[model samples]
Target chain A: MNPAPRSLTMDALQFSGTVTAAFSHDFKNTLAIIKENTGLLVDLLAMAEKGRPLDPQRLATLAERIGRQVQRADRMTAELNRFAHSADLPEAQTDLGAMLEMAVVLSARPANLKRVGLEAVTAPPLWIATFPFGLQQLLYRCIALLLDRAGSGGRIVLEADDGRPPVALRVIARTAEDRIPAGETAPTPTPEMTGLAHALQIRLDWDAAAGGWRLTWRDVET
Target chain B: MSERILIVDDETDFLEVMAERMTHRGVHVATAPSAQEALRQVEAGSFDAVILDLKMPEVDGLETLKAIKARQPEAQVILLSGQATLQDGIAAMKLGALDFLEKPADMNVLMEKIRKAQARKMLVVERRAEEKVKKIVSSRGW
Candidate 1:
């Protein structure tokens, strides 16, 4: 294989590692919350056994909290599972909206840590035959870059548009007043990201008017 | 007096449940949901030890630990995180954290660490008091 393809594979592996690590960290937090709540219940029950009165209301609340954490863990598990399978196929008929949503979900933890609000705008399904993992890596890298620029009190919106010959996806940054002023250098995508985009045949561009990055590719089918 | 400690974490649910559990074990507990709040609480009052989450939003635990140490060198801090890397653990310790514990840490193990922190803090306080007395005596030429 050429050095370019080999490097792209390494980049993909690195991206997968980062996403998996973030997901696992979140999953551990969910588990920790569940453990603490259950431990609290056990402590209360032990007290009751030793003659302290049991507060049925308190027990009910703890139970509810545990239930919610369990649901959270379940959702995280499903998402990670789906993400892992994305690499199984080199190219597949992928739902662009769903892919964007998954990217948003996986990037949520990092965005929150930076005090940035991230969300995916709802859109109708747009199908495309593409390398799922590569596309995800591209989307994630774009969002990560935007988040770095957005800083605190910033919001990022991910949108998918099926328009013209090249269906496009955008990562819009609604940041504070510190946006890059006109006449100054705009941030450029890293070499790794550029290489990944090239391998996937996606056109990645920074849209100055939109205050975000736009990724366009041809041959998107319904 | 019971051991007075502050627990700082961004997760409200974890904070609430952990505070209740610690309180039940006879520790006087206070909680902060952010690094700013934790700093405020530290400025407002003294704690035997601070249980700090390593991965808080805005100011993370290592930065907070440095700030707490600068403000009150006597304050003991224990770093806790759901995903603490080895490098983070070492950095925390080098920044004056008394100990580092991973999330879902056993209650017994946490309590033991807290107890050690309290003891170490008491020793520091006592040494400071002794130094103050010696300084006063020497200044008075007694």
Candidate 2:
């Protein structure tokens, strides 16, 4: 297998950095919660030892809270692990739905920060042979762009359509008001995104009627 | 007087636990889940220090810090972030933040900072009162 182009490699690195940073921040928050809760438990126990009445119910609730946070952290770790392995193989047969879901998961923090709702609609399995990491990177970029346009109190939906030979992925933005004005134009893909799409043999287009961006690629033999 | 402080973060669990711990330590703690609510609380009541999260939905910590300072220049703000960079710390300091601490901050360290914040706030209030008295005396010509 040949090495990826420098520009694509640079883009992927940046994307990975962003996703990793966001995940780390989330992990820190989860850890902070657990730490504080455990500290509270210790404080309560000490008070009990000093003659303060211990409420067993409160203890049970605290334990439950910690358990929930642990579960949350576990899920985040699993998602991050999956993301790390996305780059393992340069090209592989990938499931479009799963890939889109991963991209949505990676982009969740950024979207939440902007007060935008992001969801991945369930789709039937659509397999494609392409650069797995590149596909994810493109999807993330598209979702990010849509999130920006969506602004606060907006929604972004990701869905994969496998009804036809050329499988397509759509990223739709739903805002309270029309994002583009009569004289203004919709946001377009960046040069780097366009370049990546070209390299991956994916046709990227803006669908005005659907008010979304479409990425369609033909299935290729691995 | 008990130290009055407001803890602001998007994480409800964090807010609840921190509030409980600070209250147990005898500090008057109020919690806000968003910048909007934090601003409202700040306007409705006075606090010696504001514990703000650096990263939040909508308005971020830096922007909220600016707003808090604008409303009350004497307001002492301690920024907390889960993943704070050096640049973020510097920026917070430049924006009149009392201090910056990463999340999972040592309780002892945070309590010490709160004590310092309360002391500083008192000093600021006393100095302002003194300046006002001096101006009145000077204008009255003894």
Candidate 3:
């Protein structure tokens, strides 16, 4: 599909609200885990005070878990803040690499556990003139959903080729979506991605054949 | 008579451990799996204290605290969890919780805390009984 007339801009309120709500939910859940870990640390300290031998393994695991959760929460809040700031202008010339970095950092836990490899295959930094919030939402959802479907003991390959002509992503999953539990829904991708795609007048292609997913959009020479 | 104490949590293994440990230490222990069931048990029995886990799928520790305190103001409550969130600790304390204990709790330490809370409950009951006596005597009703 041909891109929209470069004359229009995305709305500010819609972009900010979408990112904020997603981050806040994730942060709230993280806060709950942090609270629990802190309390456990307090209990561990008390146990040690009475001359009871502490289990070094358990303590180390607790420390690692606490550190992971804290890092996760920090990254989520940071991304939310960045996404919030980008709402000032629509169709800004932005560095997609930085946004991808933020997304990768935010998904460290799941990505690490999934053993998924994300590679930036672009030769130089790909600067796209697009709505930042919309792009972030789109990429986040796509990556997160692929990760979720990858299962606990699985691997997925993600690559971004933001080359000069057309931009595309190749996602190769080691597991099938049918493997995911029926009760849990993969995190919903925001409408901003679809909206931006609509505004760009480009078809956002999603196909999961040959054991993977592909997203591609040919760059429209301005 | 054994000092009556209530234990509420969803995890069966932990519940069994706590109940068995507390029972072995000469405290009368009763167990419930959910906050709703806990309140039901509270209304049905005379107890000295309660042990609650903070995060449950249906109802959490904070809601349980309010319900338990409202049902039996004299019953001492100690929140328990492996993942006890900070908000849960503060909320439990503000709502008159006696203590918040983390999971995989040391049996001896938990017993000591429970005993102290139980002692406080005994004192409150005694003081209320004394006041009742004083009111009757002063009114010349007895």
Candidate 4:
């Protein structure tokens, strides 16, 4: 069997793979703590089984937390598998709704969820002709920041409108201090998001006067 | 029949919370704090889907996914992370994850994704079974 030519795909694969490697490396320590805590819960459960009275509140909390991590771990396994394999498929005629769904899912940080609201305004599923996840993550980061900054009561509105060709997604960042999380004094978009916006040919405009930020992609092929 | 969902993560607290929440949501949930334990559960149980964390001690997310797919090919996998970067998100999607959800994800969104994953599971299972049947029938009947 003949293998596909490297020139067509090697670079993108390597680039994304390296980035994910770095990302996982960043979260490794946190993951370890979670594991340790999980072990603690098991011990507590064992003690309870032995007729030992554990802190009811602590036990309940531990149980709740353990479950969350399990779910989280499950999600990561599936995500990494899907991502590593998605590189092999031709760029999907991606749907905007699905993209929006992914963006919300990716922006699932405590700050983003509590501080801001994701209002998807465009219903027409735009058929995008590019790497969907890549673009989705990029856009999600941008919206995440806005949501993070907005604090617990902040708002971010996502809308899609036709420009030169295919409809372009617009992320409106509306932030307020109340939207920011405790101990977090400010809100900022990550370099990854900015870099992605550039790569996807999307334009980002921040209005300091209006306290709003906007991202738009023009002439994106239909 | 109980709709069992497997949850794998390094954090005991997070796993417990997820199991509790899902259980409350009327889904049968299982929890594993480490990739190895998760693999054990995957080997033993016929879970409708799996929720995996990106980073964990000993067995990491990618390796665990490889193991799960190898053993339980029918299990639907979803990736979750607290420190998700643009790269990891894309990588997860590329790797065959039904979806990649960031940490502290919205409950509504998680439930919605779960539904989508479960909804697709039957179709995927039947298709695989059909393929095997076709191969068997074609060789004998044709």
Candidate 5:
């Protein structure tokens, strides 16, 4: 295969593999909870069979817990479905805020596992005609990189800044500690990250005063 | 005798439900909602076995298992994970875990493992006692 096609294929494969692995781990944890709840219910029934009175409240609570897990799994699958559909169109008018929110949800587990708080503070909803999948990849990678830099006990606040026709998004770490030192050059973006941002017509700038990197994009035809 | 087991998982529901089921089966059970809490529990009390979830928020299962073994070498640890790979199992075993079981594990199977763990723990304690007595005798030149 030619180098360009091979690179694109590899990027696609890597993105899908990572996203699927993360979602699977999340789904499995949810399933494990449901399984245990069911097991607990069964044990309760068995006890009742042996003349132990079942507490109606306890049974109700178990049922609620199972229901909650089912809903949690459903939401995760929905996010995965939306993410999969991002590649269906080459470019379209997309809600940047919603896309960023979706990326946050998709990447929340890893961030939480790192004990880093990632909160998205977006400006009023902004719609841009752009490549959705490429932007998604870029956003997810940015969050992952920030979490790695922040380590544990750190907070990262992301903002979809409203500028002129070109959109601006900021990701800032409040604390001075952590991997990305304040007032220093931005952490180097991987080749893949740079390529994704370039394809999306986005420029990355490190704002030392803001304590994070900002992504800016100029107007482009849909 | 009932086996004393500590169950650790980040999911509160899973922890509570498993603890209840194990208690119903005549095992003395304690639950920790996170690996950090599990370490605190390990430091506070000894258990015949520890049923630890592989994936947790911080201080993952393998790391937690190492800490447990360091603090209490005699503690038998059984790792439970929904996303455990072959490498993870091997690493867990190398870190002194008694067994690695996947999530949604059969309760009966787990019960059997716990019983075996309890028996093995008893043997470990007995062997340690024998070694200690032997060392004391030689040191005293008695």
Candidate 6:
């Protein structure tokens, strides 16, 4: 493959890997919680064996807690399932809000590490035709860049402007301190971001006044 | 005296469950929902072992480990990560963590690690005591 193509391929793989790692971590934590709960139940049984009366209500609540965790794990895996299949097609009709939602969830692990909040605000649903994986990569890069600039104790609120035809996204950093560094017109995009943005055909505009980032896609076949 | 273990994780379910299980095993266990709380707990009471979750919202596991070791040099730390990489494990070990274990960890394995951590803590405490005794003896020329 050509160098550019290879580089883009690697970028895609890296994006997928990052998301998978976060998802796997979440899944493991979920299982850990469940395992601990089950172990607690076993302990309770052991206590009962030792002539300590087992509260029927406590047993019921424990069972319910385990059930709740099972459901939580099921939802997480379902989101992960959809995320895994995002690249099944090179391009598809994708919901703008859902896409951003996935980006928020996947990038949350790192955002939390930096003490930055990443939230997907409610937006009117709009479907657009584009490369799902490429768009995801672009969003991921944008969020990563935002976090880097935001530093610790910052928040990035993401919402879509549905009034517009292209449905532009507004990723606003809640704190003014996280705004673009002094004298910098915009946040610098990493090489991967440049490559993915070029491939996906999207534009990023830094609004210093708004203290956030805005992404506009004009080639959408809505 | 029974072993006093401190469990720290953001997930309440995990912390509650782990605390209950360890308590049932006759180990005196305390739980912290966040690294900050864990730091406070460590300052308030010395523990034989600290089981810290790697990923947290504000203060991460590495930072927490550093703080704990600073406050209590003899304290033994065992890090737990849901998806720990080799590099993560190496970093934790270099930071003086007794061990790094992946999440959904086997109970038997964890119990064994806790025992080892307790032993390591004892050795560290004893070594410090010995140094203090030597210092005193030298100061008295005895």
Q: Write the per-residue lDDT of candidate 6 for residues B1-142, one digit (tens) a residue.
A: 5788999999888888888788777789999988889999999998999999999976889999999999998899999999899998999999999999999998889888888888888888899999999999999999
User: In every candidate, how many clashes are there?
Assistant: 0, 0, 5, 72, 0, 0
Give a tens-digit lDDT track for model 4, residues A1-222. 965434313435544664465436434534544654555666566768989888989867666655665676677666655556544544667777666665554454423326356666657567766666566556655664565455546666666665446455666555454222334433465555556666666676664543445656656676
* Tens-digit lDDT string for candidate 6 (A78-150): 8889888888998888888898888887788889887888888867778877788788788877787777566
- The parts of candidate 4 lying over 4 Å away from their true place are A1-222
In model 2, state the lDDT of residue B53.
99
Question: Per-residue lDDT tens digits of candidate 2, residues A25-122?
Answer: 99999999999999999889888999999999999989998999999999999999999988888888888888878888998999999998888887
Worst 10 residues of 2 chain B by lDDT: B16-25
TM-score of each: 0.95, 0.95, 0.44, 0.42, 0.92, 0.91
**Model 3 residue pairs with clashes:** A35-B84, A35-B85, A35-B86, A36-B83, A36-B84
lDDT for model 3: 0.66
Model 1 captures what fraction of native contacts? 0.72
In model 5, the Cα lDDT at residue A10 comes to 78
The order of the candidates by lDDT, greatest first, is 2, 1, 5, 6, 3, 4
Residue runs of model 1 more than 4 Å from their true location after superposition: A1-6, A176-184, A219-222
How do the residues B45-103 of candidate 2 rate in per-residue lDDT, one tens digit apiece?
99999999999999999999999999999999999999999999999999999999998
Tens-digit lDDT string for candidate 1 (A1-222): 544434777888888888988888888788889999999989998999999999989999999999999999999999999999998999999988889888888888889989988888868778888988888898888988887677798878889885456788888887656454244345788888888888887888999888788888855545
TM-score of chain B of 3: 0.90
> Model 4's CAPRI class?
incorrect
Candidate 4 global Cα RMSD:
19.9
Weakest 10 consecutive residues of candidate 4 chain B by summed lDDT: B12-21
Best by lDDT: 2
Candidate order by decreasing DockQ: 2, 1, 6, 5, 3, 4
Per-residue CA lDDT of model 3 for A1-222, tens digit only, reads: 966533224433443454454455456556545555655666667768988778899778667867887897787776667766665676787775676665554454346435554544333566767766666555555666776566645555556665645666554555543342334433333455556667654556555353444556555542
Residue-level error in angstroms, candidate 3, position B128: 1.2
